[model samples]
Target: MRSCIPNVLLVSLLSTSAVICSPAPSAPPSKGTTIPLTRRSVHKRSAAEWDEWAVRHREYVTKKYNGQVKSKRASGMNLLTDQDADSDYYGSVAIGTPAVSYNVILDTGSSDLWLASSSCSGCASSSGGGPTSAASNSIPLFDPASSSTFKNLTTPFAIQYASGQATGTLGQDTVQVAGFQVSDQTFGVCDTANGVLSSPLSGLMGLAWQSLASSKATPVWQTLAASGQWDSGVMGFFLTRFGNDSHAKELEPGGQFSMGYVNDSLYTGSIDYQNVPSDQVAYWTLPVTSLTVQGKSISLPTSGSNQYAAIDTGTTLIGGPSDLVQSLYSNIDGAQAGTGSWEGYWFYPCSTSVSSSISFGGPSWSISPDDFEHTQVDSSGTQCVGAFFEVNTGDNTPGWIVGDAFLKNVYTAFRYSPPSVGFASLSSTALGENGVDGIAPSATIGSPAAVVSSTGKASSNKNDATRSRGFSVQILALVWGAAGGLLLA
Candidate 1:
C-alpha cells in the first residue's frame, strides 16, 4: 500500500486496525518471549517501482487463491513481516542437526514451508532458469545434501501461487525459532520453482493451525505447542512502518514475531479480542461492521458473497469486491482506475487527505495520513498509488482480504484456543512523540473503548477463547546478519 492513500483513498491504511467484536481477556502471558524479525535487505527501488510491484503482487495472490484456483482455505498464522521496501519480510529459521541458517518469509496467507533445493531447476545456479529480480539473485540457495539431519519424504509436495509454483519433495528436519525447537518437522525442499517463489527469500514458515498445512504434517507452531513451548497455541505479530524518507538507512526493524510469549512494552492500554467465526476459522477471518470515509459510514452491499474478512499479513495490499472498492475510492478526490502498466491499481492525487477508518466490531481504526500518502507516483510526488484493489471473486462466495496495507497500523495477535484475532494501539514509547498511537485522534471510530485486561491474568473459562500473547510493533526491515547488524526499529 502506498503511504499516502488515507481517507477514501486511504481506507486500506486504516484497515490495519480492523478489531474483532469479542471482548479481550484479562490475562497476559506471565512469561512471554520475543523473537526479533529481521526485514530483508533491499536494493533501492523508487516509489513507482514499488507501486508496480504491489500491483503484480496483488494480482499474483488473487489469481492463486480467488478465481477458479480452488485451493483449500488453509488455516495458517503468519508472524508476517512489514517490508521496508514493500516487497516482503523474512525471519531466521534454522533446520538440520548443525542447524543451517535460512531467512524465510513469515506468511500467514498460505500453508506449507518450502525452500530452494540444491537441485532446483531454473534456479540461480541451475540451467533451466533463475530469479528475474535483482533481489532474488542475491539470496542463498538451500542444499539438502549439506544438512546431515535431512530425511527425504516422498509426499509429492507442491504449492501454486499467482506468480509461480514450488514443486519438491517433502523432508523432515529439526526446525528452530528463537530458542524453541521442533524436531522432525516436515517441510518442502523445492526441486523446481518459478514466479514469485524465486525471490531472495530462502523459504517461508507457515504459522496456521495443523488443519491448513499442505504437508498434512504438523506445522512448526503446532510442534512447539505440542512440546509445551508456551501455554497455548498463540502467535503474535508486531508490524512497524518506515517513512519514505528513511531510505538512507541500510536496514530498519520493520516488525517483530512472537511465537509463545508476549512483550507487554510494545503496546498501550488493553487489547481488544475478536472471535474467528466458526465458518471462517481456516484463516484469522473476522466480520467488518463498517467502513468510514471522511466521517461518513459507507454502506456495504449485501447482494454478493458471504461477508467475511481475513487478516493476511503475507499480503502487501488490501483486496475487496469490485463494487465495494469502486465505492470506497469514489470518496477520494482524484481517484481513477489504473491505466497501462498500472492496471488493477487505483491512482489518486498525491496531495489528497485520506481521513478514514474501518471497524471490525469494537474500535474504529483511523488510517494514518502518512500511510495514505504511501509513495509518490512520480518523481514530483504529485500523485500516489492507492493501496486498495478490487478482486471480484464473483457472487455466492467469500471475499475481502486485509493485508499489510492496513495491518501495519496496530499490534495484531492471533490465538488458536478459540481461534480469534486481536488488535491494540502501539505503545507510546514505541511510537515516540509523533507516531500515531492507538485509535487516531478525532476520527470518531466506534463506541466507547471496550474493557481491556489490566490484570494480565489468564482467563479461567476454558471456552472463553480469548487467550493472547502480547507483542508490540517493532521489527527489522533488513536481514539479521551473523554479526549483530540486525536493525529492529
Candidate 2:
C-alpha cells in the first residue's frame, strides 16, 4: 500500500516545452535506466504509535483487497501519513509545462497518478527551496495556471482510504520520469487533499496495469510501453534495508528502480520468473507454490484462488491469511498472537531469529532475519513486532500481499510483455549486513539464461544492451520524515 489511500481523485494539467519535455528521437534506446529511491526515517515510535499504525495499516489492507474484489479494481489505497512508521521509498517526476518536478511514491499495487495543486486545501507546505532531506517536511505544489499547455479534463477525481481522501480535477500535461517523456498524460491535480498526502512527498505514481486505474487513464508506464519508448517492458527494483543501521540518517540512499532492463550488478545468479495468471492481470498477482518456516514446510491452501500473492512494492509489511500467519508464527519459540487492539498481529522475543522463505513456482527465496523483526514492541525492547501480519480479505482475493519485508530480500523484476514477475538473489554488496537467514548451501540460484515467459518460452531480448536516445532519469532511493499532520485549511 502507498502512504496514501488509492481513492478516486481528479487533477488537471498544463503543457510545457521545456528541455525535459523534448520530443523523443526517431529510434528508441534499448538500454535500461536507473532511478534512485530515498528511504526516510522518523523518530522512534512509542508502543502506542506502533499500535495505532498497525491497526490503521491492517484496516487499509483489508479495505484495499475487499475493494479490489468487489470492483474488479482497487477501490481505495491506504497511504502512511507522516505520523505513521517511516518505511516508504520515493522518486521524483516532472509534470506539466516548464517541468515542475515533485516527489512521488512509485507503487506497483495500483494504477493512477495524482499530484497536489497549488490551490490544494489541506496539503503540507515545504519550508521553501528544495527539500534538503527525506524528512524535510516540505512539498512542492503544482500550479496548473502557470503552464500554457495545461488542459482541464473536467473530470472530478476523488479517492478515499481508511485514513484520508484526496479530491480534485482530472487534467492532461506532459510528464517526464526516468528520462522518458509522455505527452498529454492524464492525472489528478488535487484541490482538497487531507490525510492522502504527506510533506516532502507531493503525489503518487501507480505502475500497475491500466485496468486497475480509477481515473481510467493510462498509467505513465503503459503509455511509454505503448509508444515503444521502452527498450523492454521490464522494470526491476532493488530495495535497501536501514531499520537496523544505528548510523542510518533521516535521508539515506535506499535502492534503485531500473526501467527496461535488469541491473546484473544488483543481484547474483540467474533470475527466477513467474508468470502472472491471465485472469489475475489487474495486479502483479502470482501463485505461491510453497512456504516454509525454520526449514519446515508449512501447508498452504490448495485452492488456486487462495494461493495468489500480489507483489506490492508500496506496502511495508507482508500480509497473508490469518490461519497461515498464525501457523507460521507458531513454529517460532515464544511467538504470541495479538489480541483485542493487537489482534491480527504477532509478537515474539527480540532475541529470536525467525528464518522463513516463500516460492512462486521457482527456487525458494530466503527472507532476511532482520526484515522479520519489524520494530521493538515493549519499553524494555525485549519484545518486537513481526513484519508478517494477518490480512483476511474474507473473499477470493490474493491470499498474500508481499511487500518490502519480502521484497527487500531479493532483486525483483516486473515484466509487462508476458505479464510475469522475477526474483533473483541479491549480490553481496546489495545484501549488506543482513544476509539470507537459512538458505541451504545446495539451494539452486538458477542459470543466467534469458527470462522465461509464462508459457514456458525464453525471452530473447536483452534489457541492458540498448541505450535510450535521450537523457535518463536516475531513480535514486532516499529516506524521508513524515509530515507533522494532515492539516486542512
Candidate 3:
C-alpha cells in the first residue's frame, strides 16, 4: 500500500539509520555522464501534521493487504501492486521534435513515464514558478495535437499509487534529456491526476524494468543505451536529502543521476552487489539476509517466501512486516507507539540515534543516524518521527520496502548485464562531513568493482577486469540492447 499523503508527511513518521565504510579505488569513471539533480521540499505542511497522515498511510497499506491477501489466496494470484510517491530528486527533459522542456521526477521503483497534458481537466493548473495557485500556468503540458512528430496510440493508460491515479492517452514522441535525444519514445500525457501531483511536479519518469511498465513501449533508458549515446549501459543515482543537518542538508548545486557510467568519486569502499530475484526483477528487489539496529540484529523470520526487499527511490519511508517493524523500534531508547500525533507510527526522542544497517548478500550496508528522524518538533523537544513504518504487501511473501531514507547513504548502481544492483557508502564529501567543498572526492578502499563471474564476486584489484568500466562502447551498447527494455528517466 502506497500513500499519496504527500512525501513530506511520510518522512515525518518513520525512523531508521546505517553505518559507513572505507572507500575504494576504481580504474577511472566509465565514460559515464551525469545530469544535475536537485531536492524539492514538499512545502507548507507541519511536521506533526505530516506524521499523522503518514501513520494513516501505514494502516491503509496494512488494511489493504490483509483484505487482498485473503482473496489472492482463494484465487491464487501472484501479481504485485506496488506503491509510489515521495520522490525528492528531479531533472529536466524535453519531448517532441521542437523539444518542449518540462521538469520531471526520476523514479526507480515504477516503470512508466507520465506528464500532465494540455487537455487535463479537473487538475491543478498554473504557470510560471514561485508558489503557484490553481487555474493558471501550472506547468507546460504536452499537447499531441501541437507536435508534428507525435504518434497517438490507442492504448489508454492509467497508474495508481498511494495518493491517487493518473489517467491519460498513450503516445509516442521524440524525448530529449540533456543533449541526448531518443526518437519515438512512448509515454503518457495525463489528462487527469489526483492528490498533490500538480503545482511543482509536472511528470514522472520510471526507471525500473519493463516488466513493471504500464505500456509495452520501450523505456527511455533502453532507447538511450541502444542509441550509442553513452560509453556504458549502466545508470547511477546520487539522491540528496533536505534538512538542517550538515550531513544531508540539501546540496548547493544538488545531487545527480549518471547515465552510461558510474561516478568513481561519489562513493567510498567496495560496492556490494545483489541480483534481483528472477521473480522480483520487475522492481529493484533484493534478498535481505538480515537487518540490524546499532549492530544488534533484529530477529526477523528467515524462513519466509517474502524475504526479499525492494530498494525504491520513488518511496520516502522504510516498511516491513508489523512484527519486524515493532521489534526494530523496541531496541531504541524512548521510542514510543505513536499517540496523538498518529497511529502505526513510532515516535522517538529527537536525539535518539539508531545505528541501523541492512545486508543484501555480502557485508551489511549502514544507514546514517541523521537519516533516521524524519520530523522534529522543537529543537529540544522530546519526540521526532522516524522513517520506518509497517506495510504488508498483500501476499504471503513478506518483503521490505526500503526507500530514500536508507538509500541516501549509499551510491547505488543498477547494472544491466547480469541484472543486479550494487551499493557503496557515499563519499565523505557527499556525506557532508569534511566541509562545503562541493566537489566529490575519489572513492575509498573497497571491492565494489564490477563482477568477474555470475556469482556476484569482486575481482582482484590487480586485475580490475571484473569491473565493467573497461567494456568497449560497442559491447556496452550491445549489452544495453540485450538488457530487454528496462527504462530510466
- Pick the lDDT winner: 2
The best-first sequence of candidates by TM-score reads 2, 1, 3
Q: Judge candidate 1 against the unseen true structure and give its global Cα lDDT, from 0 to 1.
A: 0.53
Instruction: Tell me the tens digit of each residue's lDDT in model 1 across 138-199.
Output: 44456677778788888777655433455777887766554344556688777775432322
Q: TM-scores for all candidates? A: 0.74, 0.82, 0.73
lDDT of each: 0.53, 0.64, 0.53
What TM-score would you give candidate 2 relative to the actual structure?
A: 0.82
Candidate that beats the other on lDDT, 2 or 3, i.e. the better one: 2
Instruction: Name the top TM-score candidate.
Output: 2
**Candidate 3 per-residue C-alpha lDDT over 83-131 given as tens digits, one digit per residue, 9 for 90 to 100:** 2212344555667645566555566665667777767653442112222
For each candidate in turn, give its C-alpha RMSD to the true structure in angstroms: 11.6, 8.8, 11.5
Ranking by lDDT: 2, 3, 1
TM-score-better candidate, 1 vs 3 = 1
Candidate 1 Cα misplacement greater than 4 A, ranges: 1-36, 40-55, 67-70, 73-87, 125-138, 195-200, 301-306, 394-398, 433-489
Q: What 10-residue stretch in candidate 3 is worst by lDDT? A: 474-483
Error of 3 at 8 (Å): 11
> Where is model 3 more than 4 Å wrong at Cα?
1-33, 41-48, 55-87, 125-135, 194-196, 226-229, 246-252, 303-305, 339-341, 377-380, 396-398, 433-489
